[model samples]
Target chain A: MTETEQRAGTRPIRVLIGKPGLDGHDRGAKIVARALRDAGMEVIYTGLHQTPEEIVEAALQEDVDVVGLSILSGAHLTLVPAVIDLLQAQNMGDVVVVVGGIIPEEDAEELKKLGVKAVFGPGTETDEIVRFTRASVGRA
Target chain B: MSLGQEILRGDRRALARALTLVESDPHAADDIIAEVYPHTGHGIVVGVTGAPGVGKSTLVDRLAGQFLARGRKVGILAVDPSSPFTGGALLGDRVRMEGRGSDVFMRSLATRGHLGGLARATPRAIQLLQAFGKDLILLETVGAGQSEVDIMGFADTTIVVVVPGLGDDVQAFKAGILEIGDIFVVNKSDRPGADQTMRELRQMLHLGPQRTWLPPVLSAQAQQEIGVAEIADAILRHSEVRLTDPEQRQRRMQEAERLVRDALADQLVRGVVSRSQADGRWNEVLAEVAERRLDPAGAARALHLEQD
Candidate 1:
């Protein structure tokens, strides 16, 4: 078990799970969202087909602890950086940003350089994600 | 140290807790801000925005690691989209950073349905981080659309990331993302067509008259960690230049003034509406408006008159 699991008690981390763009495959996104929720964090799953504006607006109002994006349409190249830029423009540079699904290793590195905290690829265990989140938020 | 004092002294843990309180119960925001306000304005804020799939998150992760290597304490705000189905957020940004969460300085926020591409609690969150003594703060939003551009008003510097084969030029033009980018990054440089995309971007940038700050176009293979250092250097340079610009300071102050006024107006309107509802006056006004006995504007005017 990770240190986070050992330290996990209460104080669930709140995460905002989003699906941006016209991507229609939401099965993975929803499953991950549920997994995060079951892991004890408050998960807000923004339904499929969200515009960038809608996603940002939701992040602001919900006051989420993190922004998790799941995109499978290969739009990560266009969408992920845009989200990061928008947050920075809004003076929200302190929020942890991560992405999951179908991201290539090369693209993942690009995103990290752009200021994303982490990127999860296919077959990553939901528990590992939960543990990472707990550790990131310092709850562990 | 007391929580308030710790926050003022730039304690990361304290800042995180304070932010949690503000989000869960905004009634405490004023108190927390009052305590930490004096310690802010010492950090550089960088905004990274672009359309979906532009590899923004990986860039951020790499940049944070770069800054960490430089011994600078960093704070990141990764904004996620709100769930339309449930009005909540899934908050998954921390997954990328993995073990870095041990740093005790990073946080994430969901949009929670706030408009203009900014998390409503984002400013407060940044202030909390600033108070925590973070030398640099980065905000990564969900996408680079128009609302994202509007939110750029809050940052000291804004970096826009675009990837090759994404038709970024056309999208940037359409979304006005190009206008707001202080620096443009062509991520995924190893991909075919990256050179053409960069060349086209350079030409597009040069098409306009040169401004005081020339936006540089840099290429990065983020997955390979190539050019990450150059990107960080560019951000620092821009921040340094912005700090020295009097006009930039003036613009920030102006923006702050507008935000303050807007917040006050929203609060006042909300207060009056809620109070009227408790006093049964809101229902009466609504009835009148619904029955066409009085226009909604007229009813609102009457409420304002009563307050006066």
Candidate 2:
């Protein structure tokens, strides 16, 4: 482990997990949250029905290492871009932002180009999420 | 000036500064973490999740106190709900944890409409705390809804809190809360139906396949502080069990990978679109799509294909 990992051995990786827009299907989001927690990262999950502004503001206030967005309503194009824009407008381009839930491969590429660090579709192994986040946050 | 560096050096003041930067300037926070990337990964992250009205805040308060008493510096990241109308946070967790604020490093973050019971800046804040020499970090989510359960992904040990008298076995199971718990906590144990809840949880646990690690369901009265010590112990125990399992570690790494990939995609896609929009390409394409001159897929393809 690196020095950061050594230090983090005593502290947890903090992440802000959110579900943006009106997507009511949160089962996958919740499962991922639990999986991340089980893997030793601190998670702050924003409840459902959040606007883009609220998501950005929460990210600002929480000071999280990573931001995970879960959406299953096929609104990834509109909502995801809006969130990325809000974060960038707020000068938060570096906080790792990821999205999950029912995203198609095509949309995933679009989201990736929009500065989403990662996109996990359904059946994404929980362990994959933990690994990517740990690495992204430099814990790995 | 780099919060990540300051955190690595265990500077409390610097850690605070870093958290502030993360909360306001996430881009800057990223630079900070990049600088200090080599010095993280040594903390125990605990997540406390449960249904609403289960006194989760109170339980967190007591648990933090316990860690403080043990001489471990604690970092508490409490995720609060945002106001629907104002887009601001009510942030009630801070008020609930008023007394412990001075002792432990405590910060309450409003979810601010981020779904899944998570706040956006929470990860950066935890890094700051780790850099500040906090040995243990406690992340208390809003409540045990599906969104709240999703937030559990951030914890090394997850304690799913429930209350007695909520409902019968069917109701409890219907909530689907059973599947997410690593350690089941029946808070409000002093209530009349506490034992019944505990028994039901235990029965459910046994009915499941015999895994290497079987989650334990314990009772607690967060208001009275009853079983708080046991709850803490259970969390620690779960952590130990998790640590020993190589499969668990692998699973965690994989999950982290998914999170990172998804985040990267989100960031990159947004960047490309924004840059294109700034150059008037986005609007032009949208207009073309709207006028039936080009298909949406074709427009998207042209936009990205041109970049490559």
Candidate 1 C-alpha lDDT tens digits along A23-74: 7887888887887766656786666777665565556544566888988989
Off by over 4 Å in 2: A1-140, B286-302
- Could you give candidate 1's fraction of true interface contacts? 0.14
Interface RMSD of every predicted model, in angstroms: 12.3, 14.1
Kindly list the per-residue Cα lDDT of model 2 for residues B19-44, writing each as its tens digit. 66665445556788777755555668
Instruction: Grade the docking of candidate 1.
Output: incorrect
Candidate 1: chain B TM-score equals 0.91
RMSD of each: 13.4, 18.5
C-alpha positional error of residue A115 in candidate 2 after TM-score superposition, expressed in Å? 44
What TM-score do all the candidates reach, one by one?
0.69, 0.64
- Number of colliding residue pairs in model 1: 106
**Winning model by lDDT:** 1
> In angstroms, how far off is A19's CA in candidate 2?
34
lDDT of each: 0.75, 0.73
